[model samples]
Target chain A: MARTEIKIGGFGGQGVILSGYIIGRAAAIYDSKHATMIQAFGPEARGSACSAQIVVSAEPIAYPYITTPQIMIVMSQEAYTKFSPELAEGGILITEEELVKTHNLRKDLKHFSIPATRFAEELGRKMVLNIVMMGFMTSVTGIVGVEAMRQAVKVSVPKGTEHLNLNAFNKGFEYGEKLKSGAA
Target chain B: MKADPKGVVAGAYFIDGDHACAEGAIAAGCRFVAGYPITPSTEIVERIAERFPLIGGMFIQMEDEIASSIAIQGAVWGGKKAMTVTSGPGFSLMMEHIGLAAMTETPCVFVDVQRGGPSTGLPTLPGQGDMMQARWGSHGDYGIIALCPNSPQESFDLTIKAFNLAEQYRVPVLVMLDECVGHMTERVVVPPADEIEITPRRYWDGPKEGFLLFKAGPDRVPPMVKAGDGYNIHVTSLTHDERGYPVMTAAAQEKLVRRLIDKIRLNSDAIVECREEQTAGADVVIVSYGITSRIAIPAIEQARREGVKVGHLRLITAWPFPAKRIRELSHHVSCFVVPEINYGQMVREVERCVAGRTRVERVSHGGGAVHNPKDIYAKIMSCGKEERK
Candidate 1:
């Protein structure tokens, strides 16, 4: 079975785990693939340097955690520094552009940056930054379909915040489409 | 029996194993739960506490693990399908009650989401160290049923199975989950209530006068009569006769204890469930359970690609240990490799069942994390080279 290992790293309350959950639900529920997500535990999850490990596969996944992630998303500098070295060769690295400064990136790897926090703020709620990043990740990697992610976001978010979250997702997706077209 | 339609939350959701287990208990008609919350296991009771109130069930946060363990038993005799949830440390505290449940033939569920431990070790990490304890933790020789679940889905499904087995055999059934599977989030599809099977408790419906509390039924499982049923019955830990009276004689002890043990030992074929793959003409077989079974898959696949004939025997029911099947596979397989979170626990059983007919090796760990598939693959490579008969 083909498997994709994805890791999302950020401090707690940044919705790092929730972002992982949305992607996992999108793939497993909407895209009809098997998805498993494991959140970092203990004190690390309380406030600092938390992470979520995800695996999406065509078949039932075994050996749940990622050894070297094929896709790494980082929202904080600590996470980027801690996890960037373990990214697989030619892996895609997505980052929160305003929160982290990228330097000495591996030449073989592809780097994609999004001002997710800014996008969320534009939507009048900063907590939706994780959703913004998810939209960006979907457009950049095409890991999950646009319609599937929209459906996952609706079911996953709080009842009243669906409209705002969808707008945040579309803003991020629009920017990603510009980047893909070499216009940004 | 079909599950009560009201209890089932029919939907597909992304949830963790602990939450799924709570849903499973709710679906299985468990109306009473007592637990002193502990890490990796607390989420189970947390969900129960939130859901129980609205469902006409009871969730009690007892003073300690000891209280939590016995409270479920008290509720069981009161005629509620009941359960207690705990981790390794709390599980140790509940050991005495587990034995008591077995002796009294109390049908109840005990969930142990295992963590690393000699004593409260790795409170938030995964370990299968309690595998032996679940089987032989309590003092004295008695039989119990234990099921180990590998994923969030199994955690949900096996919990219902645990309650069913507990009712079917009138024994205490343990749902053994490690920290990894307990906390990992996955797509868990909880089916419609009518689609789910429920095992109704074997309650006596006979005339209350002169009713025997411990009389063996056709399958050797005694029917339970709820407390205050007008039948004066005695349930005790001491050796007792069918009348449920304390019979201190050696003959009484023999009769009571043997039935307790043989109820499981003789009816093992019905209680045992293992997932076997590729055993035919294989040189080596991998025996594992819980999260360890899933971790061994990649290594098994790697070995198969390298032209090694390897099979997997995953224990869904860890106790009433799948001895007969292991013995049958032992005749053809050249060797066995066991990898678990603990240094060596269930591997001993694998060795015993193989009976020197084939060599056995252990890829052991101390329980902070899962086995690196490469290390398991290394062991499989060496075991595959054993001289086959």
Candidate 2:
């Protein structure tokens, strides 16, 4: 079976790592796919750009790094610019349009630009933009189920705010689904 | 994946490397963890702090790395498998005491999650800058076992291995982790508790009447009794005779140091581990360790597909450098490529091992980033063409 790698990049506090973790866990727990997620944090975890890579494989994974990505998700302009060069031909590039203005995406590559921040703002929480972006990713790639993603987030997130986060994820999934079917 | 007899199974979970190392220590039956919080190394102590209490173990955050090292030694003397985790800077502070553990033949594990250094260079960046330091950090002529774990899962499994080896040899074992492996989060499978075979440090069940703490015995690991065991335990840092007493005599010091050194030196065959990947009929061999080795694997496969006979030798146990294996492989491979995060630390060992037989070239980088596989593969492909000429 072929292996799929997804790269998520954004400035710290964007929940970039949290989104990667959810995707990895959803693939493992729900889809029964072997998954690995790794993050690289700078000393300035609060201000500097943070990046995470999640590899989902139907077969057991040996090495857990993604040098080249088949799917790229960027939450900020800086993240998009940094990761765009690594996207392979025929790859999927799903990014937030509200934060990043423009990207020099290859013509053949599939690109989905969602206003993740705006969607989260409508939900009354800008911090949940990562979940919105993740929902969009799952809709386009079908890499994992939205319910599986919710369960993964519930298990990993700190207790007491599970309901709010679940609502945010569902809203995000709906936002992505509308865009995918050209119904939005 | 085959089931490890040590009750752990493969399951994907999000865990930082430091927490994984702590879990590895616990699974290895390390009941005592004594350490002072040092940056990059702090999370290891934190994970142990949170997990040890839950697992019915002890976690003591000492005032400094020195005290932590001392406490770990004390715990081992008290007949408990103990460990202390630290980084490059803290490792430098614990060197003197590490010598004490060596001379006293204390079987405890000390993990050095290496960062950029030579005195607090980069507190959070990853660097394999401690390879030579691990070998010669502790003073004097002594042999020690140092294992390097490349990923979170290995960090967990190898910590157990470190404890087992230390217990078997009656010496301090070093687990060398870099900042990358110490902090990176990955999916790890934690086996069931009953699956692991844990070997505690060998203790004497002989007569309690006249138990000598440092008596030279058949296993070289003499039976040790604690202070309240009704036996006078004289564990000292000074060069002493086998009775665990200080002896200033030159002949006596020679015998003592010789035995301390000989215990590990004589058993070199049992302590060395080097992992081979597609080395049977290869022209270019990539030699790496820790996290870099994980990258080198895919790079080797890529090179093989491109029609280059490139193989890999990853070091799980860095020190007690795999001299014999490298020397053997040198005769067949055209070149040995040693890639590390440091400028050039481990390459020196690879160069020394293959001396005069094969070319030892290094693709070294030290700015807190890992060597990209493309660079390593290009170097190997270039070396392959040069060999044909």
Candidate 3:
């Protein structure tokens, strides 16, 4: 069976992990696929670069960690610096446009950018930036269905705040759709 | 019997292996847990600590590993199912108590979420280096039961199995989990409480007048009893008679130790469980446990893609080492490829069981990250080119 390896990277407390978690829940719980998520753990504090590796497969997962990711979604400059080069040729690269700047970009891959941090601020919850990224990634990459991603975000966010997170997700998803249609 | 419906959270979860183990322990009716928080394994006790209070269970964060290890034994003797969670350094400290549990026939589980280690090597990385330690580090010739779980689901299932085995054999069962499996998040489907079968504690119900604490029943497993229920129980770590008194004689040692080992050895056919895939007619059979078994899949498939017949034997039970199956496979396969996180721990067991009947190829590393599948693929390819049996 085919396995798609994805990496989500950012500093601590950015919900980078929850972003990966939502995708896994979407794939494994909602989409009926096998999803495994492994996050980097070390003596890490806030603002330190960290990453989560996710593998979604049609069959049982083998060799769990992401050796070379086919999808790289980075939200921090440090994460972009450390993980972008590891993306395989012809992979999809999604970035939080307001937080990460592109340089020494690979030519063989399709790159999409979204102002996730700005979208979250517009939604009045800066912490939901990861959800915004998740929405944008779902629309741009189509790795998971939009409905499954929405269900995952709804169930994963804190109680009584699902509406706001969904708004943040909708903002990023709309922007991604615009980018796909060359309207933005 | 079915599990207590109060503790079973019947639903699907996206959780790590450690958390799944905690849930499994609860679903299996574990009521007391004493542990010292260690990385990779701490989440187990943390989850247990949170859930225990609601279910009338108790969780103690003991001062150190030594205290944590022995505390569970105390809880077991108090008529409750108990367990202790630890990693490498803590596992080392719990060795003496493991011997204590074996000598006293304490039914409890010890969970070692192994990390890269000799000391405090890689606190958060994965390793299967402690496989041998789980079997032999406790000292003495008493038989032990250890289980290796590959993923979050197995971590849940095997923890319940570990507790049941511990109760049946009245021995300390080790749930050996590597950091990768313990920390990796995956989908775990928990069935309803009524669907989960549990092995209730084998309690002594015979006349309490002339109770001999250590006397073996027909199954070679002595039934357990509560201490304050008018039954005088003397449990110890020394070589003791059926009366639970230390008898420093060699004959006493022979009887006590022999029964301890025989209880597990004789019942090994029932205790040992292994999952074999595609070993019917293959050139190489990969013997692995814990995360290494899952990591070998791509290598197995890669070798197959290159026209190599590679079979895989994933050890669901590590201790009592599945010798009969390996001996049978030895005559049928050309070689056994063992890929483990340690330099070579379980490979020795495979060799001992194979007895030179087949080529035993080892793919090994120290501890830390998992083996590169390409490296394992290369080993399988090399072994695949050999003559078939």
Candidate 4:
């Protein structure tokens, strides 16, 4: 892509920033592209609608803020309601199935939903939900390669839990592949 | 000297400017850091707190910005490279100590990840409003070095340069990072230990029996001796002589203060740095620093595409104001456009240097966000048209 703008939004504890970081790192470090990630800062980010914006480009990203995000991964109802309307025409919308309600979405957008938290719970750690979502994002959008995201996730997660996170990512990736093949 | 291997994290990784700055401090051999965490700048201290222990360094979370500012000075006197990080409000709280550091001629770094503010404004947004305050906030005729990095990679590289400048000049150096540059994340490649060069403190190896503590040699910088190093030293904020005693006379003030100002003023040729592009034959130039410089690139390109003959001058070191270069360009260029997040801080400097030789246009923003490139391009186009007329 010439330039791809991605916005990830959720509450504070959902690792919204980390998911953006993983995606940005995958593109910038592993895939040899330029990526700039900026997170929502200050007091309001604690328990409210926090977000992270990532810009992936073939060249250096001069403008940091996203005007019209080409992709939005919302993990909360508030985030969905607030940010979904701002998605560009013919953009991609990825959301957590159990958390966000799809309503009044743009018809031109390519929408994908996954129960990332439930998948993480099935993998025995609810904290890895962001990683699962990241895996799904990688597979669904193909913004970054699968192996590159896996490498980024390995180095990014907390020590001693890389195995669990990788498993969660694999589960989400498998689900995304199944959905893409129209078997879900 | 090459960086110490223990402090160097040699690899390619994606990290924010704040974390990259923390790594630069470690790589620059910063052994002690004292800070009170604040928004937009907390990540710097947090990263330092996490990595300092492993590098055999110390990180102290002080009660507040006041204590945090002075605590780093004490660490410097105790024979350690020290620093403190903060945002606008904390930076305001630190002005007094900054004066003290200037007076005492301490070698330390102060990382001000600036946010929008006169008083506690916009903690989450970016601002370049502190440019003037960094130079004159401390109410004195003393000199300090301040650098503004435009990207995360420069944030890592210039941070080390900040420490080196502090050591070389024996004065506190400021790393003036706005919120945008501080929080913006990107790929940073930290070189191996052998690739980095460090400037060690110029310690006095002469006899302590007849030492003049505040005396300067040919370099206009006094050699330092650590406390508890068996040397009698007196460090105070008052005007003193070479012996470090309060002279309290006009002569004493001139002798002490003149050297303090001259140290950086005379050596500004070595201290000041900037990046210039297409200035060899251009009609208009855009002068900018910090995040504004990055945003100005596309505007410059756009103006060039419209055949405006535009050049770019990016300020890597904002202090000692690259006046000589600007003055030289003033003679040839028809106009100089300055775009900053502030309403007009550095624009005044450009006007002063131009001295009515050329039109100086200010593309000012009031700090919440960066400038729209189209706005800057419009200014450039107008300037170019004016020049053509």
Candidate 5:
């Protein structure tokens, strides 16, 4: 199956929801891939951990929710603790180094420690942590192109918020570039 | 034996019950579907969305069940057959709009693919906990048409019938399939569109002069023209007369309310449906519907092969209670076995219909597990065997 499972987890209202939806839409609309976005949230929209799974495939998708995830995106320390065990062995784990202090990280899994929250704050948008991570995901995994991600955000974000979300997205893309230069 | 054309298309193909319901809605000529995703019913929304776009129909995922219900009412007012599907929790959320649909006499179909409940008890599991709720969920004395399908094919067939009845009576109808029937994968035969009989909303072609929205001319159902159509079709939740204008007077409420309930009550004989096996001279009669009926049929057949005079009553239409058939079956049978997925919900109705004339017993299971036919057979043989006395 060409379908790939990507999971995003964080406390509710952290924009993990927007990130997952954008990813799913990007795959479906821009890349001609079938996509399914499944979300689980606690009763409280804020302060409670939330998780969303996005499956993008070239084939017609069956079973919208993914049973196993190939990539894990954790935005908070609690999110990392909650979803760390469920990540597929040898899968990639990307998280903000500022918020998630201690992680029960495994040896085989590759972890990317990016200052997504700091980047969002630097860009004057505290809620763009998910957007930054979305950028890092597309850059690192090449699962979705940055242009497709930007187009996805443009189409999905509500009427007035498009320009600000796109700016946050570009800031995230720049952050990924910095990480790539440091590695080089 | 030469096969009839209608029966020729009733063969089986592999499909899930939820998928069959979506297909059934389309076959019923449903042009609009509005729903929010809830387990056991999410497949219905997904399937509808996938197909509706291609068929030039509208499929919307509203903010909540309440909004979904309202959106469907709007679409139906736009002159399209509309439907919504949800599970127990979502169905609970939809009761308010259901009451609205009743008061306004809006024609639509609501499918409640039941699951374990009381509050998100189990998302992926099966349950028949919503039987009572389906009948009396909305707050008020009102009537509704509900059908319970035992298999995937019935899910499709009954969904079509639900829309037909809704349009025919200008009332809301429900397809109450439980999680077992909703989620179970089985073979289903999908007939071409031309093979199925579809009923659209009856619209009055007469001029706008002297148009009373609530008034029934020759037939009890008033012709409903679409919103943008020149006719002034005013419908509301308030008490209204044939003119469709709200009136505080008790006289107007009396006439309108009576017609709302009487429409179904008067025509229940034609609406009631059931399947029977060896009902004549049988000592034991097992009564069931939906997934429970699925098990009861085999158990009754097994008992018959074993030389026991056990008969089956599989109820396809649960609402209106199929009271006449149950009463007739009760007269001939000594014992009644009610196998249900709920804890004695439908059994109560069976008891009431049977009264003290027949000994009515319940074979019940809930919280997502189905009752085994062996258990029902054992219960029947123990209580219903003629030689036991």
Candidate 6:
């Protein structure tokens, strides 16, 4: 890609920064592309709106901040409300189905939703919801290759929890594949 | 000399500038760090605190920035490569000790991950407002070296350079990082220990008896002796003689202060670093540093697309300002455009260097965010128009 700007937004404790890091690492380290990730640095902690912005490009990324994000993955109502309007024209958006209420979304935009939190709970860890979202994002957007993201997730997650996170990822990936195929 | 293997983490990883800076310090054989945690810069010391113990290094969370700054100097005297990290407010508080470090000729590094400032301005946002402050914040007439990193990779690389320069010159080196670069994450490849060269401290190995503590060698840099190394070394901030006694005389002050300033000023060519792009036969050159350099790239490319013949001079080392290079370029280029995150700091230096040889434009912003590429592109276009006229 020439340059793709991605914004991952959610309340704190949702692995918002970790998800962005994984995506950036996948592209920059594994795929040999250049990626720059910037998090919203503020006093916002758990239960407040938080975000991470990543710019992946074939060339070195300049102007680190995102002017108009091409892709936005939102996991909270507050994040959806705050960031959805800033999505670029015809941009892609992915959100957690159970948490965010999608209303007044742009008609020309491509939208996808995953019950990532529910899938993570089924995998016996609610914290891996972001991993599920990552998998879903991989399936829907294809911004990063599957193997690159898998490797990124393996190295990024805490040791001893990789298997559960990978399982959650596969579940979300499968769901996203089904949705893309019009089988959901 | 090659870096110690214990201190090097050799690999490729996606990391933020703050974490990369800590790794760079470790890879450069920095064994001690002291700092009070502050925003944007807190991660730098946090990484140091976590990784230091593993590599047999030391980290201390001092009560404040003042203590943090002095503690690193103490560590240096105890035969350890040391550094302290902070943001705008903390950097302001540490200015006194920066002067102390300069006067005592202590080899150390002070990392200022700048944020919007003048006293706790925007704690979490980016700002290049501290460029001038890094050069002149401390009182007195002493000179210091300051390096500005535009990206996470440069943050890692230049930090090692900062430590190396500090050791070579026995002066505190400043790694000037804005909050944007500090918080931005990118792929940083740290080479193996054997590949990284470290500048060993200039320690005095001769007889300790009657040793002149403040005597300069042939290179004008005084050799050092650790506090516990059985050397009767007297290190004080006061104007001291060769034996390091507090001498209250005009001759002593002149001799001592002149060397302090001359060590860096005279050897500035060796310490200065910058990158030039397409400057030859160009009408305008954009002088920028830190995050602004990165942000100015698009405008430069756009201006080139519009056939404006624009060049780029990215300042990798912000001080001992690159006056000689700027002066030489001023003869060729019709104008110099400087876009910084501050109202007008480095632009003034560019203007001073140009000295009416050419027109200089200031693209200024009061901190919080970086300049829009469109705005810079507009400036480039206008400069091109002015040149045509």
| Best of the candidates, DockQ | 3
Candidate 2 on B1-389: residue-level lDDT in tens?
12233323335566767888887787777789888888777888887787777656899888999999999998887767799989888899899888888888888899998888778888878888888888888879787889999878788889888988887878899999988788766667787766676775566777766767788775566655665666767888888876788889989877777777777777767788888878998899999899889777767777788888988898988877888889999999899998898889989988888888989889888747667778888888889889889
Residue pairs clashing, model 1 = none
- Give lDDT: candidate 5, residue B26: 76
* Fnat score for model 1: 0.90
lDDT of 1 by residue, A1-184 (tens): 4799999999999999889999999998999999999999988898889999999999999978998898999999999999999999999999999999988889988999999998888889998898899889989988888998999999889999899999988888888999999998
Model 1 Cα displacement at B327 (Å)? 1.2
Worst 10 residues of 2 chain B by lDDT: B1-10
Identify the runs in model 3 with alpha carbons over 4 angstroms from their true place. Answer: A44-46
Question: How does each model score on TM-score?
Answer: 0.98, 0.90, 0.98, 0.96, 0.66, 0.98
Stretches off by above 4 angstroms in model 2 are A1-3, A28-30, A58-68, A76-91, A97-109, A113-127, A145-147, B1-12
Better of 3 and 4 by lDDT: 4
* lDDT of each residue in B1-389, candidate 6, tens digit only: 99999988788889999999999999988999999999989999889989988989999898999999999999899999999999999999999999999999999999999999889999989888888888889888898999999888899899999999998998999999999899999999999999998999998999988888789986689998899889898899999999888999999999999998999989989888999999999899999999999999999999999999999999998988889999999999998999999999999999999999999999988889889888889999999998788
**Chain B TM-score of every predicted model:** 0.99, 0.93, 0.98, 0.99, 0.94, 0.99
Please give, for residues B1-389, the per-residue lDDT of candidate 3 as tens digits: 99999999999899999999999999999999999999989899999989999999999999999999999998988889999999999999999999999999999999999999899999989888888888889778889999999999999999999999998889999999999999999999999999998999888888888899889977899988887877878888889988898899999999999999999999999999999999999889999999999989988998898888889999999999999999999999998999999999999999999998879999997878999989999998787665643
Displacement of residue A139 (Cα, Å) in model 5 is 47
Measured against the true two-chain complex, the DockQ scores of the candidates, in the order shown, are 0.89, 0.46, 0.91, 0.78, 0.02, 0.90
Across all candidates, the chain A TM-score values are 0.97, 0.93, 0.96, 0.98, 0.90, 0.98
Chain A vs. native, model 1, TM-score: 0.97
Error of 4 at A16 (Å): 1.5
Looking at model 6 chain B, report the run of 10 residues with the lowest lDDT sum. Answer: B211-220
The residue pairs found clashing in candidate 6 are: none
- lDDT assessment of candidate 4: 0.92
**DockQ comparison, 4 vs 5, better candidate:** 4
